[model samples]
Target: MTARTAALAIAMAAALATVAGCGRKAPLDTPYQAAVDARKEAERNKEPLPPEPEKPVADKRFILDGLID
Candidate 1:
């Protein structure tokens, strides 16, 4: 094969590798809710637990405070 074709192939492979490595993972679960659930489950099992998380700031906003969800 020509050197030009070889270089092209290598460059393409490098770009593909970079793209694959850059894959971003999104959070699959809500941390606040998860914490709340954990606390509840722990209490149910007779284990001592800290107070549950308070309502999120976003939920306490007024209608005119910000854009609609």
Candidate 2:
């Protein structure tokens, strides 16, 4: 089609994609939950449970402490 029509279609598609990603209350925890479920299954089967993943530390300085000195 014409250049103007093509540009308008691209702009609308971009806007639709941007809006579609909004409104999530929190990120998915599927990986962590899967790990927990695996551990439970292992326990039921009398096998060793894998170690739980560490929760993220919220402190900004936790990362900077090593580099600061």
- Candidates' lDDT values, in order? 0.84, 0.83
Cα deviation of 63 in candidate 1 (Å)? 18
lDDT of 2 at 55: 57
Model 1, runs deviating above 4 Å? 1-27, 59-69
Per-residue lDDT of model 2, residues 1-69, tens digit only: 999999999999999999998886885767767788888899999998899866555556576689876
> Candidate 1 — what's its lDDT?
0.84
- Which ten contiguous residues of candidate 1 have the minimum total lDDT? 23-32
For model 2, the run of ten residues with the poorest summed lDDT: 53-62
Q: Tens-digit lDDT track for model 1 on 1-69?
A: 999999999999999999998955976657788788889899899999978787767656687867755
Q: What lDDT score is found at residue 18 in candidate 1?
A: 92
Misplaced by over 4 Å in model 2 are 1-29, 56-69
Q: Residue 32 lDDT in model 2?
A: 64
